[model samples]
Target chain A: MQKQVEIIKANGEREFFDEGKLRASLLRAGAEDSQVEAVLRHISKELEDGMTTDHIYRHAFSVLKDVQNPRAIRRYSLRRALIDLGPTGFPFERFLAKLFASQGFEVKNDQILQGRCVPHEVDLVAYNENKLVMVESKFHNRMGEKSDVKVALYVKARFDDLSEQLFDYGKARPLDEGWLVTNTKFTENAIKFGVCAGLKMVGWNYPEKGSMRDLIEDSRLHPVTCLPSLTKEERELLLNNDMVLCSQILDSQSKLIELGIKREKVTTIAAEAEALCGR
Target chain B: MQKQVEIIKANGEREFFDEGKLRASLLRAGAEDSQVEAVLRHISKELEDGMTTDHIYRHAFSVLKDVQNPRAIRRYSLRRALIDLGPTGFPFERFLAKLFASQGFEVKNDQILQGRCVPHEVDLVAYNENKLVMVESKFHNRMGEKSDVKVALYVKARFDDLSEQLFDYGKARPLDEGWLVTNTKFTENAIKFGVCAGLKMVGWNYPEKGSMRDLIEDSRLHPVTCLPSLTKEERELLLNNDMVLCSQILDSQSKLIELGIKREKVTTIAAEAEALCGR
Candidate 1:
């Protein structure tokens, strides 16, 4: 076997290089199995000692760009798309709520509930008849600021605070689970504790199979901010109205013109949104 | 004019006292003109330079307790009733929500919202077709701990954050007003700042006439904890079930039995509740 290599993380943490993990991420971005393998092998041999993961990602992104269309490239940048959703990240939380709402979960944004020790403000709560899920959105304006294990731990503690109230109060069955969501990636230990603690988590690419990126792609409820057809001002229009998904634009297609998007361009915006949401 | 006598506040701040405000309070508490006048004249004669408001309040509470009934006394101890309603003040927030709900406003509690400067957690949001109201409940376990002017300042800043979004989105008209509610009292500066800033406030006795105490009395929503007939455990049962208003118990009178109050005592509890809510 070749000598094991180490990669530095965005937060200056170091870990052993894992080719399998990198390959999985690329495949999730719509790379074919053959393409993912080939790119990982090529990138592996070219990797420098103590290379940061950002360099590795950039190298891969550049290679992927050559093979993918602008649209594919756009979807592949789901991580950046989410980060671009907001300067405040409230828009991103709205986007996540829409995704759950699409899945038949009733959602409330920004629920402040009493925790055992002190008052806790939760980012979102989604529920149906059987399950309640609390979401804590750790939004860092900068993409590199990952939601670490510390975030997961604190969320679990907060969830613990209200878990009892769920059963005792009106129609509050115990929460199905607490979800720690982030626009960026999670630290490895965050995944470790969360998996062990059974706190559901979603982030850029934490869980190998059903990560945040994978979930968005599978759901087709991409944040409206991700639509290439929209300008920053138009995106702001959607955001200010708490419209998160491209699908929302499709549902209220007429809202485009009402939003000062020109009458003729409404069709263009709708077509783009329909294509992005895969409807 | 009694030379605008000064009273030392709980926080050791001294401010000029107004007797008109005091008389209005006593009259609102259901005291007759002759009684209120007599007490004011008597209490005014004894007013010393720098008497803390706490001492003055005790004197008033004792005097008022004499004229009020056992049930009225229970209702009058709004501060203790609120504290007794909670291991956490979730019940008080629920009570405030119910107060609005009864007024034909749709209510949601613990609404997490993004403010301009940061994320703000509002206690309740009540709205209807014509207007929206955001409520921030300041619950203190101790009676002397008041919601100060600093709270009003911060809440005003948070309201500025989402005020614009209301007009832009889903059935949201701009909030008609933002209300700061407390189980206890407001500092003089808090009332002044809130009034000047156009932030409406309801506290134990801040607004004198239609104060939080008066609201509960007029709405007939006495805290379940205020019932002297029930034991601590039964009160806990009521609090655990989100039962704050005495009116709620009258609707589900059988619940008193379900909660382990004696079957015979069920009628007793019901009568007390009905009389308190005037149902």
Candidate 2:
């Protein structure tokens, strides 16, 4: 019989280390069976009582990096790269706008639309011929932070205010849907309020289907920050230039050259981005 | 004619320094006409362009302190003392609870009551025979920080949730009214939404007639931190023991004695508190 080791989560809850869960996640990241087993063995050996899940994640990421699996590393680093878009959260909003635009919706960012009671500066507004959606992106820079019910309560109120107000998006139309999107998880109560109020919510791993991760994966719209070949400064420069996706880098190699990267290095970086995004 | 000097406000707005406004505020704080003139002379001599209103305030506070008017000093420092109660804002909540309790309302702090769709941890709940009020205290430690429209919108939603939900507060009753209280100011849009939504609001200097300052002055429920005689550490010690009001010190002299304060110092502090609160 093996002794189960308890590990602390990012939100400070304790649970037994589930080797099966780790194996499944690695496999989902497209790791080979041998690579998955090796990673699990390494994690088990390093496991200790009262260790944090954040530490375990960093350890697993490092092992994957050492195994030279660029695609797996890119997939594993998706959530963290989203967090790197913040401190101001403006980049995350732009990222979401681009993500939606790729999905065949016309998107606008930082729009000040009049509500029934007052005006609101909505983060992202996406519309098609069929539907117009208003979104509020709740960005958290820290790892363990979750958007609580108070946020949902306020977002629902904002949505309610804009529900009957006509806005000119090609034509005068009322808001068909409202969304509260986050780069992190939503608290359980937040999800409950969102559901009860009929306000659509999209979190990092929430709703089981059509989550933020699912949308990004489905559209192959991984952010430029997910590229291992680019340094932090390079990624920030790209984001500042309004280039969010790896596909954007492939389209505009001149952005890299303008940032003072050598021709050979730019080619190498674009090659990695191409492979990561399956371009 | 003296040239009007433009000074920066805490919120970055530039305005001409108004001597009449300064004189009126000093008189309102109980300064004598002579003291007010003396302070005005000092301020005029030291005035410069582009100086911040915050700098003007500190200079005025120092000049008032030098005049050795204890009551006037306590009253002048009242707004600042409320700001010093924060960082966490819990003390501000407790302080508001104490203020409501003084006004013949049975008050409860930090109550988790069931709402229509979810539960909310209300800051203060106050009730009497005729009216039951749910109060949310928006505390901002930073100077010039205001509760924006988003805060008002969310608070209205929370109040709407608890409107029809019956709760046992001595007896089964639904909420009668909802109040938003802040130790600072509310944005203009917030006030607009609050008025339109019929959510009662109280801010430091809002509503003109029944603001937070008026309530505090009416009840003479000055926080212990307003006393210039007590050192910062002593004030914090008193507050940590749940002694919120200066009047509380007069009733419980043993609390001061237990903190190892000398008999004469305790007498001096209490006398200042007594003079400040008129108890």
Candidate 3:
């Protein structure tokens, strides 16, 4: 019998190697079926007696970078890329507002407004021609961390306070809805509480088919943080300049050059952005 | 040499029992100096090796209840008594508003207003001749629990949201300040954060002599739950009828009788309320 393989986790717990989880992650990143299978089989043979998941991840990542499709590898690291986009959540907030902008919403982030009790800092506020939404983002840098029910309650409670004033003395129409967005997942209880409280949750893989991943995938409004070709300093330069999306990079190619992206790389980035936006 | 006595803490840690800590607590509850020393001595004798903190609490509580001054005993149990004031926090909200009312503020509790992002439920909103303030209450059932920095941050963030609307589109006048009120105490970090953020904090013994206890004692606007004369059913009855403060019972004597407080008890309750409310 083949030896049972053990993989170490971030918290130092050891568990059996989970190929299904890896396969699902690859699929989410836009990996083709054949490539994914070949990569997995290659890693299966390379497994050490007690290798860490980090090592396994690096092995897979190298395979991805070396493989012909850089786009699929970019998509695979999207969650990590989202985390790397932030030391604080300010950059992520800008990225999300820009994503909404791509979807034809006039969006604002980090807006302050009066609630009945106290004032609140809204992470993102979006208004279409018809509806306005208040969004709160619960960001975590860790992979398995979740936004729990307390956060859901907190958001809904604040929303309830603010909505009362909105109806009584609001400038425009009362807000149509409130939203809670997270870079990671929502706890089951959070989802349950959010639904009961009438707050929408946009999280990775949450609500299955219409998750944040699906929304971004459909819109093709990928954040600048997700671009594989851009150097770290170059990405930060664009983010600092308030150009959050790959589309923003294309629109402001000269700005990217000013931020020290070489012209050839800028051309490649534009091609990638165009390819991403096309589908 | 007298053996050093160890007392268990709420979190199940044990430390040397210090009479100064006990004396400070007794003094805070308005216990006379002699009575405080005697009570501490008695508890010191009764304590055995490895006695649990809950056991120590019950012993001390019994001593407080039996000693001469019922009012002082009421002050000692103020935190616990406040917890019993709620089926939810609705009655406590009313009670807090009435306390503010005694301070010459026209106060409203549980009001909903539109914030910039969503509607929020304000616990208490007070308007005096000079200023308007928004208040948030943090109530804890446990004796040692505190309103920590996260709660402070939460309150300040919410206040920032509300104040934005006050600047942009407020009617009459914008709020003058925000205050966080709690039945127990604020953590040191909470106090530090509040001070830096310019949000006022009130709790049992925070802010030195000007604590929540000081405010309550000064105003004599005690919650009906603080009255030992009333049965639990009667307290709940008064709470449900929106008669949260002791003064409310005196103002509505007929309502107390309607809730089945006998005519004699009604007279006693009225006298106590009057005595409590006196300048």
Question: Once superposed on the true structure, which residue ranges of model 3 sit more than 4 Å away at CA?
Answer: A1-75, A167-171, A275-279, B1-279
From the highest TM-score down, the ranking of the candidates is 2, 3, 1
Top-down DockQ ranking:
2, 3, 1
lDDT against the true structure, per candidate, is 0.70, 0.81, 0.70
Judging by DockQ against the true structure, name the best candidate.
Answer: 2
Q: Please identify model 2 stretches exceeding 4 Å from their true place.
A: A1-72, B1-75
Q: What does candidate 3's lDDT look like per residue over A1-279, in tens digits?
A: 234788776447788877886666555445678877877877888988678765676466456445547655555667777786777788888878877877788887788867665567789888877788899988888878899765876687667757766632124667788899998898886787678668988897777887877877777777877665566787777878888776776678788778777654565465445544423
Q: Report how far residue A88 has shifted in candidate 3, in Å.
A: 1.1
| Ranked by lDDT, top first | 2, 3, 1
On a 0 to 1 TM-score scale, where does candidate 3 land against the true structure? Answer: 0.45
* Per-residue alpha-carbon lDDT of candidate 1 for residues A158-232, written as tens digits (9 for 90 to 100): 666567665422374776788988878887767766776578988887678877777887887788766554667
TM-score of chain B of each: 0.70, 0.74, 0.69
For B190-226, candidate 3 gives per-residue lDDT tens digits of: 7776777689898888889778788877777777776
Sliding window of 10 residues with minimal summed lDDT for model 3 chain B? B270-279
